[model samples]
Target: MRSAIHEFPDDLFTNNERKSGAVLLHITATLYMFLALAITCDEYFVTSLEKICEKLDLSEDVAGATFMAAGSSAPELFASVIGVFITHGDVGVGTIVGSAVFNILCIIGVCGIFAGQVVVLTWWAVFRDSSYYTLSVVALIAFIYDEKIVWWESLVLVIMYAGYILVMKFNSSMQRFFMGKSSKNVANGNAATSSEMEDVKPSKAYSRGSVVMVDEMMNASPSKFRFPEAGLRVMVTSHFGPKTRLRMASRLIITERQKLVQAANGVETQVIDGKVEIENGTVPEDKPTEAEENDTISPFHIPRGVGSKIKWLISWPLLLLLFFTVPNCAKPRWEKYFMLSFILSTVWIAVFSYLMVWMVTIIGYTLGIPDVIMGITFLAAGTSVPDCIASLIVARQGLGDMAVSNTIGSNVFDILVGLGVPWAMQTMCVNYGSEVMINSRGLVYSVVLLLGSVALTVLGIHINKWQLDFKLGVYVIVLYAVFLCFSIMIEYNVFTFVNLPMCMEE
Candidate 1:
C-alpha cells in the first residue's frame, strides 16, 4: 500500500485536469489566497489583536508568546498533523522539521530587516526562552536518534513543552520582558532600555488575557492609539449623522466609576446609588456640549450572526443557550466587530493554508518535482506564511522582543507538538506495538542543521547583548541558503549520505 500523495501517474491527470482549465484555475486561486491572506492578516487580524492587547493591558511578549505565535503557527501544526495521517509520517516529519528550520532562519531574518535597526531583546528573557528552545532541540534529537517514534517519546516532547509554557506564563519578568509602566517612555513609541525605564514604579504583571487596565494606554502618545482607518471609513461614516448618536467612548480615556454631573447654583446635588442627582428648578441654563451630546452609544451596532460563524470564538460555557457577547462595543466600525473580524480572518487563514498546500502539491507534481523536496521547501514555506507576516508586523510595531520570541516560540511548537502529537497517536493507537516510520535521513540531517543554526543564533545574539542586528540577519539568511543548497544537492544524489543511499531522489 502507498499514499496517494507520494506518487501519481502523469496521464491520470490529462489535458483536462492539467491544461484544459483546472491548472490555471488552481493557480489563480492560490494567488488570490495569497492576496487574501495578506489583507486579512494585516487589516482585520492585526487591528483586532492590537485593540485587545491595549484594552486588556497584555504585554507584547505575553500576547505574542502564547496567542500571536500560536495563532500564526496554527497552519503549520494542522498541516503537519494531516500530513502525518495521509503520508504515513513522511510529510509530517519533513514539514515540522523543515518548518522549524525555515521559521528560525527566515522569519527572523526578514523581520530583522523590516525592523530597520538592531532588534533589541531582553537578555534574561532571551536567555531563558532560547535555552528552553535549545533544550527542546536537544530533546528532539535524542528522542528521534533511534530513527523511530514511540508513544513515550512523543509524550516527552509534549510534557517538556507544557513545562516551558507554564514557566513563561508564571515568570513575571518574561511576560513583560520589554514592557512595563515605564514602557510609556519608550522613544518614538518603541520599547525602552533598562536604563531608560528605571524610574517607573514596580507593577504587578497579570497572566490571563483578561481586562487589566485601560489607563496604561491612555498614558501612551496620541499616535499610539492611531489604528488603521482607511478600510472602515464607510462603516464609521454610516454610524455618524445628525440624528445618529455615535458615541466616542474610550476605555483608554474613561473610567468605569465615573459619574456625569450638571451642577447649578440653586440646586442641591446628592449622590444616589453613586450617581449624581440635582433636585431644583432654579438651575442655570447649561446646554449639552457638542462632545457630551455625541456620547450616547447604541446598544447593538451594525453586526449580525457572529456566534453562528464560530462558536469557539465566543468562549462562553454554552453560547447556544445564551446570547453571544461581542467582546467590545467601542463604535459601529471595524473595531466594533473585533471578535467577528478576528474569527473571519483566522478562518480565512485556515482556508488559504489548505488551498496553498494543495496548489503547491499539484504544481510541484505537474513539474515532476520530488515529493520530499516539495514538502520541505515549497510547502514548508507556504505553511510559514502566517509566522512571517505576524512576526514582521510585531517587529515593525517595535515589539522586537515579541517578534523575536515568536520565532523561537513557533519553532518550539513546530518541533515538539506539531510532530509529536501525531506520532504519539500513531504509535499508541494506530500501530499498537509497532514504531512509526520517520524520515530518518531527512530528520537526522535537519536536526544537525537545526542545532547548528540554533547555536549560531544563540551565540551571535548572546555576544551582541541580546540584540539581532542586520549583519546577524544576513548571516542567518546565508546559513539557511547554504542549508538549502546542500539539501537540494542531497536530493539529486550529489551530496551523499554515508549509509543512506536510498534517501536520494529515485
Candidate 2:
C-alpha cells in the first residue's frame, strides 16, 4: 500500500493499480470534501448568526468571536462525531483531546517558531479570552471525571460559549478603545473608527441578503447563455471557473432576479429587473450546456449525509476485501497484513508531512506568517497536505485565503468548538450510565492540552502588540518538547501513582 501510494501514477496502466488508485482517490476526496462541507456549513451558520446579531443590535465582536471561533473548530467536531460511530468512542475521545493537544502544542508551537516574533497584546483581552478558555478547560476536566456527559453539562458548554460571546460584545468597547490607539500606529489605520462611523450613519444600510449575494458571487460564476423562454439554460462560460465567484454570481441571479445579458460586442451586462445594469466583461464560450450541467453537477454535488453513507458503505467492504484477500494474493504469510497496514499508514503520514513542510516554507517565506498567527498554522500544518492540494486545484488561481484560512481556521476549530462540544456531549452520555472509563492517562493528556492552551493564550496576550520576532520560535520549540515528554509519560506509564509489581521470570 505504501509503495503503491508513492508510485500511484505508475499504477495507471495496470488493472490493479487503477482499482487501487480509484479507491484511494475516491476515499481521500470524500474525506476532504466532507471536511470542506463542514467548514462551509460553519461559515453559513456564522453568517446567519451575524445577521441575527445585527438585527438585535448586538456587537459584531461578540458575534464574530463566538461564531468565528466555533466555525474555525468545525473539523474537530466532525472528526469526533465520526470517531464516535467508527471506533465506538475511544477514537472519538482520543481524537478530540489529541487534536486539542495538537492544536495548541504542535500547531501553535511550530507556527509560532516559524513566525519569528510574538506581538505585544493588551492584558485585558488576554485575561478575558484566556480566562474563558481556561474555564472551558476546567469544565471539560470536571465533566470527564464522571465518564459521561449529561444534558446539563452540554447546556453548560453552550452557556459558556454564550457567556464568552456576551463578554466579547459588551466589553468590546474597551477593546475598541485600545485598538483605536493601536491602529493609529499600525499601517492598517483605525478599523473601529471606520466601523463607528458606519454604525452611526443613518443611511448606511446593512443587508444580509446583499452580503449573501456577494459571498455567492465571489464563490461561483455567472452564466452567459440563459434559459431562452422555454429552452435549456446553457452556460457559455468555462464550467471550471472560480467556484466561489460562480456561486456568488448565481446567488445574485436568485436574489436580484438578474439575467446575464450579452451585448452585441463581448461585454456582458448583469440586467437586474431590466433596470439596474453592471458590466463584468464577456463570458467565455466553453460553459456547459443544460444536459452537461445536469450530468456533471449531480455527481459532484452529492449531499454530505448521502455521500458519507456511500463512502462508509464502500470503505467497509473494501477494507474487508483487502483483509480477506491480501494474504492469499500476496503469496506471503497472512500475519504480514498488520505490517502492511502499518507501512501504509506510515508512508501516507510521511509523504503527506513532507508536502506540508514544503508548503509551509513557501507560505512562511512569501507571507511571513503573522506573529499572532504562528500557533494557528500548527493546526494548519497537520492537515496541510490535503489543504495545499485542494487549494492548488480548486481556488488556487483566485481564493488563496481559502486555503490558508481553512487550514489555520480549521485548527482553531478542532481545539475549542470541536473538542469542547463533543467532550460535553460525552459527559452527557456518561451521566446517563454509559460504562465509559475516564482513564487517568487521558485526564493527564487533557490537562496538558488545557495548560498548553492557557500558556499560549497568555503568551499571545503578553505579546499582542509587538512585531514578529524570533524568540517565539525558541518558546514554541520548548513548548513542543514539553508536549513530547508528557505524551511519552502518558503512553508508557513511566511514573504512575501506583506501580505494578514486577512479574517473576517465566
Candidate 3:
C-alpha cells in the first residue's frame, strides 16, 4: 500500500514566494501586537482613573467633570502650552483659546445633543452639573482678572471644592428619600418615563443574538467539503439549511467537473481490461429558468452613491501611485525630505497658533471686550474640551459611570499631576539666587481650577442622595455672576484684595 500523501513540487520561485509570505506574516503579527499594547494602555489609564474616583468617594458626575476629564486632557493641555512657549507666548495663547473654542462650539455642542437624547437631562442634571459648570466658568474669569494667585487665593479654591464635597457627602444620606420623591413626582407630572433601563435591556438582548449567530455560523460548515468555491458553497448551505444541503453539494461537484472538462478537452478516451473509465466527461449544459437567467446579471454591478464614486476616483489613483512610488520614497534622500516636511509642518502649526490669537484679540478689541474676559473664556473652554470628549465617548460606550469617574480622576490628576508636574519642572529650572518669580497668571489659573473643583465638591455634598439638583445649577450661575462682576472690577483697577492690585501692572 502506497502512502496517501503526495510531495508538492519544489521550484525556486515557489520556495522564495513562500518564504516572503512567511516574513510578511511575521512582521504584520508583530505590528498588530504593539498596536494592541498601546490600546490596552489607554484602557488601563481609564480604569485606573475610575478606581481613584471611587476611593475618593466622589460621585460619577463629579469624578468625570473634574478628574478623568482633566487627566486624559493632559496631552492636549501640554501640547497647547508647548506651542505657546515655542512661539514666544502668542501661539501658545492662541492654541489654548482655539482648542477651547473647538471644545465648546464643536465637541461639547455635539455631545450635548447626543447626551440630551441619551439621557434627557431630567431638570436635575441641568440644575446640578450644568449650572456648576457655568459658575466654574465665572469664578475662573475672576481669577484671571486678579492676575495674581496668592496662597490665600489657592486656599479659597481648595475651600470651594471641599465645600462641594461636604455637601455631596451629606446629600448621600438623603438620596434615597429624594429619589423616591423624584420618582413619585415624575410619575405624577408626566405620562412618559424615559428610563435608561430601556436602553440597557436591548443591548443585553443584542449580546444574546450575537452568541447565537456565532454558534450557528460555526456549525453550518462540514469538515470534508472541499469545493472549488468552498466559501460561496458554504454560504449557500447556511442560507437554505439542511433541506438544500445535498443539492448544494451536487451543484459544487458539477461546477468543478465542468472546469475539469474544459481543461482536458479533446483528450482520447480508452477502456482497458476490466476497467471502464471516460478520460473526459461531457460538460453538462446549465440551462437557466427565467429567474436564474435574470440572476445572470451580476448583483455587484449595482450603482454606487455619488460620495462613493468620488472616494473611489481619488483612492484608486492614489493607491496606484503609492504602490509604485513608496519603495523609491523610502530611500535616504527622500527620508530626509520627510523629516524636513515634519519640521516645517510643526512651524506651520505655530503660525496658525499666532494667527488664531491675533484674530481673537482683534475681534475682542473691535467688540470692546476686555483681554481678561477673553483670557478667562479661552482657558475655561480650552480646559473643558478634554472633559467634553471624555464624557461623550464614555457615554456613547454605555460606560457613563466610567466617564464620570474618569472626569473626577482627571481633576485629581490635574491637581496632583498636571499642576504638580509643571510646578516641579519650573522649580527645578529656577536657581536659588535667581528670584523664582511665580507667574501670577499661572497661580491665578490654578486657584480658579481648585475653586471650581471645590464648588463642584460642595454642591455634590449638599445634594441629597448623590443626585444633582436644579438648586445647584442656580448656585453655580450665581457664583459665576459674582466672579464675573469681581473680574470686571479688578480688570478696571477698581478693586484690591489683600494689598495686591486687582489688575495686571503692565
Candidate 2 segments whose C-alpha is farther than 4 A from its true place: 1-59, 84-86, 105-124, 146-151, 176-191, 195-440, 456-467, 497-506
Clashing pairs counted in every model: 0, 47, 39
TM-score of each: 0.61, 0.46, 0.35
lDDT of 3 by residue, 1-506 (tens): 11101111222233244344543443343233222222221222333344455457555334544444443444334433342232222223323333333332333234334432222223332233334434444544564455432333334444555444443334324333444433322210111122421231112211221122211222333231223123222322111111122222323333333333433575332212231221111112232221232222222222245864654453344234332322211233343343333233233333333333343333333344443454445434444553555455433322222223333333333333332333233333432122112222433442454355445544443453332223433444455445555544544446443123322111
Error of 1 at 22 (Å): 7.7
Which candidate would rank higher by TM-score, 1 or 3? 1
Better of 2 and 3 by lDDT: 2
For each of the candidates, the C-alpha root-mean-square deviation to the true structure, in angstroms, is: 13.9, 16.8, 24.2
Candidate 3: TM-score? 0.35
Residue 143: error of model 3 in Å?
14
Q: Candidate 1, 384: how far from true, in Å?
A: 2.2
Candidate 1: count of backbone clashes, pairs at least 3 residues apart or interchain: 0
Model 1 per-residue lDDT at 196? 45
Model 1, residue 409: C-alpha shift (Å): 1.1
How would you order the candidates by lDDT, starting with the best?
1, 2, 3
